[model samples]
Each structure stands twice: as C-alpha cells, then as structure tokens.
Target: MAQAHHMRIGEVAERTGLSLRTIRYYGEVDLVVPSARSRGGYRLYTETDVDRLQLIKRMKPLGFSLDETRELLAAVDGLSADDTDEDERAALAERLDSFEAAIADRCVTLRRQLEMAEEFAERLRRRRAGRAASA
Candidate 1:
C-alpha cells in the first residue's frame, strides 16, 4: 500500500467517518493529533495518524475514557521492531488484555443501566394506573 501520502484535516475527517469538530476534539484531548501542519495552517495527517484515528474510533464505542485512550496510544508508541525481547512483547500483551477487560466492564455497566431504566418505566406505569383508578 502507498504509505507516502498525507491528508488534510478535512480529508482525514471524511476518510475516518468522523466530523471535523470530533477530529478537533480528539486533537484537543491528545488522543489523535495531527502529525504536522501545512504552510497555510491546515492540519496534516500521516498514515500513523490515520491508524491512531482508527484505534480511537474503535475504543470510543467500548466506553474508553480519553485518558485510557491516551495510555493505550502511549503503549502503542512504546512498541519497537528492534525490541525482540519476549518480556517486552508480553508486557504489551498484558496491557491490551487490561484494556479489553475495561471495555467488557463498561458493557456490563451499560446493560445494567438499561435494565434499571426499564424497571423505572414499569414502576411509573404502575403509579399512573393507580392514580387513574382513583380519579
């Protein structure tokens, strides 16, 4: 694939399916910042930035906080091809497992919240019927 290309912020947004505002927000949060800027002050993104954006997009739906996302990106940054050490690869794998666990916990929390909302609605319906019968 062609890795010798750059894109402006607009094109990055289009390719990533993220809004311009969201891309800017990610930059502000230090989740996915532009690699460089054009002479005209436009944000320039490289292939690495595209990959980071993809990671961020995937993590967001899993309810990852910006801080957690930042840490994950830092972990990604720490990987090196020169480091053929087993310990280093094992450490990275452990961190990824932790991230996955966090996402799973968030999914459980969301399911609980949904269940609570449903129960609350049913209680509200019961109260409404009780009031209607007395009226």
Candidate 2:
C-alpha cells in the first residue's frame, strides 16, 4: 500500500487559508481531525484532511452552524464510503439534496442583501456628489 504524504498544521493552515487556532479548534470539535500526530505531538494532516477543512471553510461563509456543518460532513463521508449500503446511500443522498437546497436559498438571500447594500452605497455616493456640486 502506498503511504500518504503528511503535512504539519502550519502547512495545512497555509494550504487551507485557515488560522492555526481555527484548525486546532476544528480538531477539538471533531470537524476536521488530523489524520496523524508527529513524534513531537504536532498535528499532522493528509491531503484528505486538508480537503475536509476546505469544505468547512466554504460552508462557513454560507452561514452553516458547526452542528450543521458536521452533519453535512457526516453525510458526505457516508456517501463516499465504499461499504455504504444502497439504502444508506439513498438516505445520505437525500440529506445532501436538502443541504443543497438550503445553500441555494441562502445564496439567493445573500445576493439580495448585497444588491441592497450596493444600492445604498450608490445613493450615498450620489448624495455626496450633489453636495460637492453645490459647494
């Protein structure tokens, strides 16, 4: 069997654009536990671990709570497992679909909020310009 290459926490943090503290916290919460530990007791991660952290990072911006993120991760893991039975796979797929729908709804809400914020900023800019013109 081929051994997977491992990275220390700093390297994983660099790759995932997450702070060391955040990574450690995630590990504590079992969101993205390290694949191994070094002789010196440093957290060591594999590429798969990094990928998990990246997924969590993406989900964070979508406003998923930690528990929700963990649930989604569990569903993803179940779906990916080769030993998952067809019945389990169907349930996991259904969970994934629900998450997808929630994400899409959140994204639409975010877009609407962003548009309103931009419009407000534009209105302010126009008001400033009008004041300057009169000055």
Candidate 3:
C-alpha cells in the first residue's frame, strides 16, 4: 500500500530472480496478482508484492505444490493483514507452525541431496584429473 516507488514486471522479475513468464503465470493462476496497473496498462507491483514474490521464489526450491503454495500464501496473508478475525488468528498461527515444520523437513532432504550431488561432482573431477595426469 505504501511503496516509495512502484516496479514494473521486468523489475519485479529482476529483483525476485523469477522469469517474467513465471510472474505473469502466477497472476493468471491467482497466486500473486499485481497491486496496480500502469497508465500504459502494464502491471505494477508494490514493495509488498515484491516481498511476496521473493517468498514464492524461496518456496520454489522446496518443491511446494501449487495448492500448497496457495494455502501458504493465504495463511501468510491472513496473518499479515490488519483485519484478521480473532477466531482466525489461532488457526493461522497453527498453519504457520506447520509450515515451519514442513520447511524444516524439506531442508533436511535437500541437504542430503546436496551432499550426494557434491560427492558425484567430486568423483567426476577426480576421474578427469587422473585421466589428464596420465595423458
């Protein structure tokens, strides 16, 4: 609501490390719509929207499904909004906690995958170096 400068789709893509197509697709899917439209009918985004896009980018690597992402965004938005109902706060808090646990689990899995990938790379490097030394 209170951004010093609005950003266009290209700026949003550059800042978020997301492709322009992906940002537009997110809008099409109702995942994260832009806050406003320019005089030229281009999409315009606020700082808050940029932060949301970054959150989506962070989630991408964790393999969250579209439904999961939608749910997470809903929970986050509810918590962040000013007029969240008293009854809904507790449930949103629980959802945030559950998401935290899920992300922790995913981190463990990703770490293991990274270790395996590093080992595979090391093996290839060793083989290549050994071949060059013998040549």
Candidate 4:
C-alpha cells in the first residue's frame, strides 16, 4: 500500500470546505488539534483530523452547542482499546447513543421550522394574490 503524505492546514481546509480560521480555532479550543506542525511553523493535519473536522461540521449543522460538540468529540477520542476498561465499553456506547439522539432531535426541529416558514410564505402569497385580484 502506498503511504499518504500529511496535508497542510490549508489543504485540509480546502478539502473540507472549512475556513482556515475555523480550523485554527478548533485547534485553539482543543477540539480537533492538528497532528503536527511543519518546519515553517504551519499546522499540518492528518487524515484523522480531516475526519474529525467533518464530524464537527455535521454536528454544528445539527444544532450542537460547542459544549455538546466537545463532549461528542471527547467520546469519539475515547474509543481506543487502551482508553477502555472491560466495564466501560458499554458506557461509552451509551454516551455515543445520546449524542446521536440529540442530533436527530435537532434535525426534527429544523424540519418543523422549515415547514412553518413554507406555510407562512404560502399564506403571504395567497393574500397578495387576493389583494391584486380586488384591484
């Protein structure tokens, strides 16, 4: 198998459609810290960081607060076999389930909001049409 070269921060940002500032801010907050730094002092990210940043993007769209995002990322980071005890695996699974449910709830709320907006627009259109017909 061919080895993959490490990606610079800008490359990661371009690939993921995230701004460089956002990537740096995520690093500053210990969210998705870069894997390493280049000799020139630029941040270098690995494929793993790319994956994590994508998850963060998805979570934000699903209405996760930063705190929730942190917890979710922590849960994800704790998945190593070295980080687990025999008894803790189940607990970790439960925590992940909770995060998934929270995201699903946010999706439902967004759907409802979109439906409400569509209905409101329809009503306004009908009202405008009625007024124009009267004139």
Location of the lowest summed lDDT over 10 successive residues in candidate 1: 75-84
Mark the 10 consecutive residues where model 2 has the least summed lDDT: 30-39
Candidate 1's C-alpha runs over 4 A off are 1-3, 80-88, 105-135
In candidate 2, what are the lDDT values of residues 49-77, reduced to their tens digit? 99999999999989999999999999999
| Cα lDDT, all candidates | 0.86, 0.97, 0.93, 0.87
Model 3, 10-84: lDDT tens digits are: 999998889999999999998899999989999999898899888888898999988899999999999888999
Candidate closest to the true structure, highest lDDT: 2
Q: How many backbone clashes does candidate 4 have?
A: 0
Better of 1 and 3 by lDDT: 3
Among these predicted structures, which one has the highest TM-score?
A: 2
How big is the RMSD of model 3? 1.9
| Clashing residue pairs for model 3 | none
TM-score of each: 0.68, 0.98, 0.89, 0.87
Over 91-131, each residue of candidate 1 has an lDDT whose tens digit, in order, gives 87689889878888988998999999999999999999999
Q: Which regions in candidate 3 have their CA more than 4 angstroms from the true location?
A: 1-4, 130-135
Candidate 4 yields a Cα-based lDDT of 0.87
